[model samples]
Target: MEELFKGVADPVRREILSLLRLQPLNVNQINEHFGDISRQAVSKHLQLLEESGWIKIYQAGRERYGYLNKTAFYSLKEWLDAYLQWGEQSLENDHGVFLEPTAYEKGAPLTHPVMLQAMLSKDKEFDGLFYNAVRTTGIFCKPSCSANPKPDNVTFYLTRDEALKNGYRACKRCKP
Candidate 1:
């Protein structure tokens, strides 16, 4: 745990982790993102991250690519979950209603195809997982909403806030 903390302590290392989250990249590719830092410095940071299990390096021919090792952060995630549980309890106490947990809370992958199928089938199982926003009508609905729009005209959002942020209003029927 100390090693993990040390690995993420530097801003440069944190930036590297952020980059890796998007996709794996070789040292040269990673260095391109930072104009001021030398390749050697980035390499050193990579070595520390690898040693701490924050990243895993793969060699393709002469190039070494670093990929984010999400499993390595299980301990860190568990630690954060404790605080999230506390926050949920506090919210419940203040609101007099327990907060409903989303699939994201259980580490379910949010995929478009899965969500689209659920919406098309009116699957109530995915009601809280995501919202279906219609591009043509500019309205978002719960997955089980009776209204069905053409798949091509619909886009799925992880949250109602995300749909609203993209200029979609809640469906009058679903009240999403």
Candidate 2:
């Protein structure tokens, strides 16, 4: 979210995250490390980090402890990883040969070769079976769509939801 991005954009907040990553520290302990700022400033940074879901703040006796919350960071990593994977083509091997997904990634529904062929030929019969996501255009289309995406620029998804979830929108031409 925009708020989440803005939350970590501050240098002080990012430093707080780095500390939390090591171990949970109480407000006083965290405040001691920053020589340039007042305890109130450190607490403000911690509060913003907690509100953004990057860290958790909990009361233990008289002190409030802050710890890294893996969920937000994990989700962030996965979301960014989706774009990284999409951009990679991730298709090359050291041998200078292009590789298709010979082994379907853990839960993927279709083989790359099969889906790639269907997309290249614009096969109508395979429309619902898979969607071709174009990395360059950030669009996903039904295999039946006339879009002729290059092999290296596309990734296949099993459903519209899968494509949308990965940040690709449906092609207006395909209305997928």
Candidate 3:
């Protein structure tokens, strides 16, 4: 746990983690994002993260890129789960157990109101926005959110029926 914290304690390490989450990047590209830091400093921070098992560095082209090693985050999750489970039990004793298996038990489906209809009547802006919004959730989309991503973790839908069926919600701005 201390090793994990140590790897994450520096601002440079946090920036590296954020960048790697988006995509693997070479040390030079990573350094480009940090104007104040030298390439050597960025390399050192990347090295620490690599040593702590939070990142991986490998040769690509003529340079090495850094990538997030997601498994290390699982270790941090295990540490946090110990205390979270205790709190859950305490809450169960104080109130009644939340027996519901799904957290979205109460959320209503999007109505796709007249406003959405008007928006869709335009040059398919609604569909384009809805598709782009789903990308933020890391899902590949379809004309109608047709389970294109296939896997539940990545699938998203536009219609309330589709979203409710596959467990997605309307975008607050797009209101799919």
Candidate 2 residue pairs in backbone clash: none
TM-score, prediction 2: 0.49
* Stretches of model 2 off by over 4 angstroms after superposition: 86-176
Task: Give lDDT tens digits, candidate 3, residues 31-104.
Answer: 89999978788888989999988999999778998888888999998997754553445552322222222321
lDDT tens digits, residues 1-176, model 2?
66678779999999898888889999988989998999888888888888888899889899899999888887788877644454566433222223344534544667777677667656565778888899999999998797778879898898889999999998999898
Itemize residue pairs with steric clashes in candidate 3. Answer: none
Tens digits of per-residue lDDT, candidate 1, 24-99, equal: 9998999999889898898999999999999999999999999999877887888767546644455423322223
Total clashing pairs for each candidate: 0, 0, 0
Give TM-scores for every candidate, taking all chains together and pairing residue i with residue i.
Answer: 0.49, 0.49, 0.48
- Stretches of model 1 off by over 4 angstroms after superposition: 86-176
Over 4 Å off, model 3: 86-176
